[model samples]
Target: MNAKRKNKILTWIATISFGVISLIALFPIISLVISSLRPSSELMRQGISFSINFSQLSLDNYLYIFNQAPEYWAWYGNSLVISAITIVLSLFFSSMVGYALAVYDFKGKNFFFLLVLLILMVPFEILMLPLYQLMINTQLIDTYFAVVLPMVVAPVAVFFFRQYALGLPIQLMDAARIDGSTEYGIFFKIMLPLMGPSLAAMAILQGLGSWNNFLWPLLVLRSNDMFTLPIGLATLLTPYGNNYDVLIAGSVLTIIPIIILFVFFQRYFIAGLTTGGVKG
Candidate 1:
């Protein structure tokens, strides 16, 4: 075959392979969404199926979530607020730390970076006890602070940002400094704009992490009102009765923010990941 024709055939094969993989990945999500529209008894009886019974589906589950369950709204709000705060704060602090590690010379810098790496090696489960105790000592338990504080200096974010920042030209910093820009001014004004791709990537990751985080929030939040979506949805199941309709519907709804987030930042995702990969 001609080279161009051979390449085109290969590309077609790759496209078909990816398309098949995408459908395989999407099946569960599609099933969950279809199941959510079904009656709880129907779902329980039939389970998730390939065969569609359009007659049996309704928006009753969604309606029940909006009208009947005030707690669900509260939990939704809590997740939104906590995730927002966590994403913003984590980006701010992690980027700063990463930038410093990338560009600056200071005492204990290596030590701190080492500590971050060590922490990454240790599972969060190992730290959970000490962190909980620390929260108790500070009396931050059952508060939003408990949820947001520990996540602000995420190790992975720091490392990712540092790797990304390494690819940035230091000449910009020197020029800004020569122009008498303050350190913070240089970072916030000049460096930050250049770090857009990295920030976007981290924002999506951190936002998703905070949004879906259940264990830490479960431990820290004593009240139902403060529960994040994951915990709240989990609570839908009890020994007496299981609210499968609302649970499935809420699970479906929970996907919206992550989707919206990816849509907004997707333009930068590939660019950021590519840059980080090359630079690192």
Candidate 2:
């Protein structure tokens, strides 16, 4: 075959492959959304089946979720607060550390970078017992701080920022220094402004992780009132029975913030991922 015909065939194959992948990825979400709209009676009858009834849309499940399940609201609020704080604190500390690593050459710089790499390889599950014990000793259990503090120094975020910062020009810093800007001023004023895309991307990732955290929060939080969304959602699954509609509604609620954030900052998130993926 001629080269142009081969290329055309390859392009069509790639397009079809992407469409299939997109459908596979979207199927579960589409199912959940359709189920969320169906009446509880229909859902109970369907029971994991993929049957669809366009005429069965009802707001009762959502209304019950908000009005009847007060704990869901509390969990939602706790999750939101902790996740927001985690994102802010993580971004601030990670950016500072990443900036120092990226922009400066100091004694033990290589050692510290190696240490970060080493830490990154260690799983959080391995440290869970020790982290819980530390939290107990510090008397931070059952508090929002317990959830917020552990996640604030995210190694992943640090690595992401460090890599992103590598692409920035040293001349910019030199110019700022020559203009009598302090190191802190240069970082906060110049480096940070240029790092918006990276920061936004890290914030979205860290925020989602914090919001969905279950095991650590369940371990530290003893009271129902302090439970985040995931913990509270777990409570819905008792041995006695389960409310599928309410559960679906709760899951939908949990995802709404992430969807909104992605919609708002998708450009930056994509740029940040591209930047990190393409370089050190």
**Pairs with backbone N, CA or C atoms under 3 Å apart (clashes), candidate 2:** none
In model 2, the runs with Cα more than 4 Å from the true position are: 1-20, 41-45, 53-55, 270-280
- Which residue ranges in model 1 land beyond 4 Å of their true spot? 1-18, 239-241, 267-280
Candidate 2 lDDT tens digits, 88-177: 999999989987889898999888888877887898888999999999999999999998887888877788888879888879999989
Q: What global local distance difference test value does model 1 have?
A: 0.85
Q: Per-residue lDDT for 95-176 in model 1, tens only?
A: 9999999888899999988987787667787788899999999999989999999899988888888888888888988898
Superposition TM-score, candidate 1 onto the true structure: 0.87
Worst 10 residues of 2 by lDDT: 271-280
